[model samples]
Target chain A: MSLKKTRFKYLGESLIEGNIKITAILAIIAVFLIFFFILRESLPIFFNGEVQQEITFGKFFQGIQWQPVSDHPRFSLWPIIMGSLKVTMIALVFAVPVAIGAALYSSEFAGRRLKEFIKPVVELLAGIPSVVLGFFALIIMASFLKNIFGWTYRLNAVNAGIALGFAIIPAIYSLAEDALNAVPKSFREAALGLGATPWQTAVKVVLPAALPGVSAAVLFGMGRAVGETMVVLMAAGNAPLFSLNPLESTRTMTATIAAELGEVVFGSGHYHALFFIGLTLFTVTFVINLISWALFDGLMSKLYGAKK
Target chain B: MNSKGHLRKIKDRIKIGLTGSAVLLILAILAVILGTVIIGGYKSISWEFLTQPPKEGMTKGGIFPAIFGMVFSLLMMLIAVVPVGVATAVYLHEYARPDFILTKLIRGAVNNLAGVPSIVFGLFGLGFFIQFIGGSLDRSLGQSGLFGQPCILWASLTLALMNLPMIIVATEEALRAVPQAERAGALALGATKWQTIQNVVLPQAIPGILTGVVLVVSRGAGEVAPIMFTGAAYYLPYLPKLPTDQFMTLGYHIFVMTTQSPDIDATMPIAMGATLVLLALTFSLNIIAIIIRSRTRSQLRKGR
Candidate 1:
């Protein structure tokens, strides 16, 4: 009976193996569709050169303006790129230090009960809807920042950047804490045995070992900041004119896509322009996410290897 | 020499002090945000708000229509998402070989899908569900889909599609975490592979699956972007009595009140009230997840 059952198992396994190829094909098609759809809309803009007028890739890149819908259209991406960079950089400045500090405290310093309390609270930040966060930024955070800084624009990049920082802080902290906790107890013990203090061991030894993991966490948070639409849409004072000053009105590529795409004429040049913006956004984020996952995979090996 | 020792002492003190203060800062931020929302939300929520119909341009009006819409739509979303999600997860975990190129591809695709921006999902939903499927349903169910477009059913289906990648990933991780020993033991006892999976693995993994379901449900409930583009009505006067009916949802109501409505002040209160309700709804799902986890842990302890 057991021998016959083993034969049946092999038969089932072979049957399952036959279906796996189709599942893989289906999964690949889903991914391809995303690229195909984004590219389909975006490709026409480049092919026609209607917006750029030069038809040359160099000129498209070198252009200094970006009025996609205008008859004599300008397609300079500098300002929105600058706007996205400025907000993302400002957000990273606030998010990284706070998130790292919070992770260290949670993993190494806190009491068990306090850690439990803190963990869920941080997770709750992740659960908060981006729309609600954006609304809060628009109605409350923007006004508060305006009063505090006495900014020219009530809604500016700084307010949005700060709000995005807050939104991303929890995700960074959680991922970083997971990294820190994966460091071997024996490593810590050996450091202490060598007369190093807890602080010395954590900063000098544990932190270095956890760099790849921490970097992955930071990168993921940065991607979240960049891709986020609502917070920036509400708070970033959606003027297309790009400026370096955080206090001045500026709009990100995402904010531009969201605010204007709905109104754009479908299958028109303007629509293609929106898709090009999305493609740029998607490529940037896709690269960031790839780096993040690669780092995570790489770091997990180090953490697990050290344990063995 | 004495100065060096003093500086070292100061530095040590600073390290400890900074760590302690940072933890306190985190706790403080959590308390402040949660406290402010609950306090403000309390003042806004009333019996009327819970029981009666929402009145246009009135802050004190109820959210019955939105609440009903939320419940019915969520139920539809879960029904649509769970079956396909679980099937995919089961295939990925239990059936697929690690070396298969297809499995590797699926894994990569799932990762990418999770990171795709929510608004992109909104765009896809608008193009696919609302335009394609919605147009079909509109023609078939004539009067139901008649005058306007983007009914409740389309909205729910759109949200379900949005939740798919997330649910599959969560469920796969949960299934992967189930112990190998139990499965081997069941098979050694001469149980068929399907029977072993059904009788031994699934029951053990219920809590983990529940955790995945909770995450998907909470995320689905909070999603506003896709629903906005796909189907949600700005001012649904009556509750959505059927899937084909037009409706209002709490998320959309908040957006309308804040952005579109004439009575901005009146909407602020409603937005706050609606936010509280949305938060509470998600929190309860989380609580159910926690209960499942604890129950499983206790069962394990008893068995041991």
Candidate 2:
């Protein structure tokens, strides 16, 4: 009987060991496969270093002309980079104020019932797929902008940026709310006991205390906007023009990658360049996320004074 | 006294006016989009439209193929995602210690995966999955027609992989939320950790797991770019049949109809209708999840 029990235990151990192996294998598969494919496509560019003679690296870096596939392809990344930065900046400008205001209203000012109603609606906005938002922007918002501002290009960066702002508003709101709610009730009570008004207590005390968390939330929002593709792809007309005017058509690295990657010849230099673009994108967002994660962890530890 | 009172009243009025306008602006934006989608799509939706195939122009047609594609691809995607995702979550939550370097590395990788743009995934899928994996599989399988093409299976696989990290994160959160006291109690009653997890913890985490599954499905269904490169044809005549079969999906259908098809007017209404259906399906899943979550919360309150 003891022998049989020991065998049964051995059998159970083996099964768990097998399961663990499988899980490890799956993780390895995902990580390696992603690295291999991205690197594989990106290899052609490195190998064909001599074929890169069409333009000097300096011209590629500093030139204002941004056509890549044309006969005399000027690879100045400044305009699109500037375009992406400008749009993201505009989005942040619109989003930060509204999100902070909403977060304050939800956490501090709103009644319980109103808070419950408002929170879910805001989250639902976050869940609305970017594709749908892009579609709405292209069809309705772009037309509205054209009619109102009489813009030359109906589909431009401003409309896309506005749509993106709406997409990101909820992320900022939710994260900021998380930060705001983490402020101890005792702190609020202490402020109130000092005969401070609710607004004064909220603005002066809680907001300062929650600054780190608020910063984390803003960083996360920036990451979302930076990595966002569909809205930018569909709405930002894919013209590789070196223009700062939000009214004119421009192409972002992400939008270009999406629009052309599928059709690019496999093992070609252009394909690797697309991968290089992907690498740039991945690096930018990854850095943003790491910073945000560190900030959030630090703030949490400082607030709670270590894990239980 | 008169000046102070007048200034106070004016300040209050201005504050109220600004706040009210901001609130009204948000509501109006949401209302306009929702109202437009519903109103535009509602006129085109009908039993015939749902059942029939696309007609001469996309406007006067149906979205039957697209609907079929969506359903088939989603089913395959769920099949691909659930096992891998659940396993990954189990490993992360149950097996891997929090302070382990490998665990931390994996956590960062998963978070990075989520942050990577969807377009990058599309590019990756196109280069590797379609050109390499699908092409190889097609050659090895040596099937004809739609099977010859890298079709539904490939698309589904790519999407499933895309959603895997989210599911793992959601499931891990749910598992983490299961009270440690309950787990300890079960262990004290002579239950093994695995047994306790299986019998006690999993039962409690079922609703959360369902929520995660629902989220994966909703996100996977809406995906367009990955499928575009992976296997989605511009116009697949018939619905995909076997594992190798090529197909159309609602997300692709809407894109093609709106952008690619020459017959714009005919396609627009049908595209809107298809969009509405996809929206309805996703919205319903969310509503159901919300209901389930509230029910679970109430149950927890009662238990406490």
- Checking candidate 2 for backbone clashes, the offending pairs are B58-B266, B58-B267, B59-B266, B59-B267
Docking class of 1: acceptable
Q: Write the per-residue lDDT of candidate 2 for residues B102-169, one digit (tens) a residue.
A: 77777777777777677667767766777777667667878434333457777888788778787888
List residue ranges in candidate 1 displaced over 4 A: A1-27, A48-76, B1-10, B51-53, B57-60, B131-154, B241-246, B294-304
In Å, residue B166's CA in model 1 sits off its true spot by 3.1
Q: Each prediction's Cα lDDT score?
A: 0.75, 0.75
lDDT of 2 at A276: 70
Question: What are the chain A TM-scores for all the models, listed individually?
Answer: 0.89, 0.90
By summed lDDT, the worst window of 10 consecutive residues in model 2 chain B runs over B15-24
Per-candidate TM-score against the hidden true structure: 0.88, 0.91
Off by over 4 Å in 2: A21-25, A49-62, A306-308, B1-27, B135-150
Considering the two chains of model 2, state its CAPRI-style docking category. acceptable
Candidate 2, residues A1-308, lDDT tens digits: the string is 49999778668966975696477457556756776787776655555664455433344377676666767666676776776786787779988877877787777777878776776677556656667777778767888889998898988888888888887888888888888888888778999999665666777898888889999999999988887877877777767777778777767777777777667665554556677777677778878988888887777777675223
